[model samples]
Target: MDMEQSRQKRSFAPRALPHEEYFAPGHRGCQGCGPALAFRHILKALGPNTVVAEATGCGEIISSPYPQSSWRVPWIHTAFENTAATAAGIEVAYKVLMRKGRIPEERINVVAMAGDGGTGDIGLQALSGALERGHDFIYVCYDNEAYMNTGMQRSGLTPFGAFTTTSPAGKVSKGQSTWKKDVPAIAAAHHIPYVATACISYMSDLYRKILRAAEARGPAYLHVLAPCPTGWRYPSEKTIEIGRMAVRSGVFNLYEIVDGKKRLTVKVRERLPVSEYIKAQGRFRHLTDEDIAYIQRRVYEEYEALLAEAAQI
Candidate 1:
């Protein structure tokens, strides 16, 4: 990036918009695709000297086509299940190359990017291995909540009571049966140095987490809550609003786990009802009043549990 571009990226003023453009405009992503915005902020924090390993998902689909590309940095294309493994190899190769005097001492940040389906389901084993081996890299999972690229299929990260092609709400059944997988908590269990949750609407928070992950020595995991307009059945314009509602409703808590402490960054002391959040999306439109009440209880229970965990920290 140029000097002016650099200044724009580093600008942290809450009101002033970021001038630097890392992901670049014009891509195959649908209107109001949440991952598109998340990728933009991620590249801003990592800067130019970064090696990326993106899995076979929306991030790879929309950005890096065979003949053309969207990424301005050195990026490698990897399979859905081995994105973390590929990134680990790259990180090792970089360090070895540096020691052998083949490369400069300037640190080259390594990041593995994947969608929730890749990271939480097919890619889980490879991700666990990379973290367990203590690779110096950051793994970013942009969670659109389901397998959006192919069809609106339910994945491990898909929330309960949400309608999907695979989990359609029928006369005898509700939507998705299981709760969303707690990927961040799973990452924390690996004893990683840094793990955080970010939403696409909150650009500043997302940028901060990316930088934190980049600076960490060992494996770092950043789970981003990127809303899917097409899959979630919401209007394109309400993408940012839905994201904010997720956080404010305490449904998608924006918290960071650092130095063994879990602190809620965006505090919702008197959180809005889960109904307010569910009613905004078409995926949850089939939910009944009783279903909404159950969801609200689950949300409150999870938030309280997080508070208890934070207290111990």
Candidate 2:
């Protein structure tokens, strides 16, 4: 369906999002920070019984400082490379406590959150270990594409031809020389019970996926595409719009893998040209016609491949 039709048909929730807030106000997130919005929704869906283990990234810095915190639920800050490991430990500890009757026998959700750098680059080993070990928790990678908290450095998950402090578009190179890392596929390779891709632009789908992930028995992985206004060189107010464009142009997609089966959650029947998405951001300003075409070709190929994979289910 068309974008307007999709919008009209959207049902964000059977009811409105919870009136209660688990992520408190007074946090110092940037204007139109996608990750910050993501955190709010995450807590709202998981509720007060959830505990979050956040890595040292944008999400950590924005919500927690030495003397202050924005989280109403239990939250812990871990190193950039050990968020998942720490969350796994927490899950084990909670299980042990409940079994020993030291704590009430109640369900408590455990979640690990990190940025793209922490997930795909610095924290890959720890994350892989946790998933392979079958930890009963959720791992969330809020991908803004680059290391936005660290001055827009190129990261493993950064899209090809996207400009960053390290990957500048110049005479020698167009931008990042490599394609974005397929972290979701890497997570699914472990045969996790649930793996999903989401974007903040589609709140209904995102919320639904998070709830499903929380309900999964074993480990669950969610890769959320969070657009960065600062790092992506877009107007702060356009963060959600840029994200929507990314999905509609096939630059990003929404899908989920359940028990080794793949399915498309939000299908775009008529995708706009990739240029529509590219031109909205300054990061791709230096891209030439050839460069854009190359990027578009890759997007089309990957999206088509995703469709084929989902069709098998």
Candidate 1 runs further than 4 Å off: 1-11, 14-18
Task: Please list the C-alpha lDDT of all candidates, in the order they appear.
Answer: 0.88, 0.91
Clashing pairs in 1: none
Q: Candidate 1 versus the native: TM-score?
A: 0.94
Candidate 2 per-residue lDDT over residues 143-228, each given as its tens digit: 99999998999999999999999999988889998999999999999999999999999988998788888889999999999999
Q: Best-fitting candidate, measured by TM-score?
A: 2
User: Residue 236 in candidate 1 has what lDDT?
Assistant: 98
lDDT of 2: 0.91
Best by lDDT: 2
Which lDDT tens digits does candidate 1 get at residues 1-313? Answer: 4433434454344443446666778779999999998888788767778888999988899987778888888888958899999999999998999999998888888999999999999999999999999999999999999999988899999999999999999998799999999999888989999999999888877776777787788999999999999999989999999999999999999999996788887788788899999998999998999999999999999999988888787
lDDT of 2 at 309: 83
Clashing pairs in 2: none
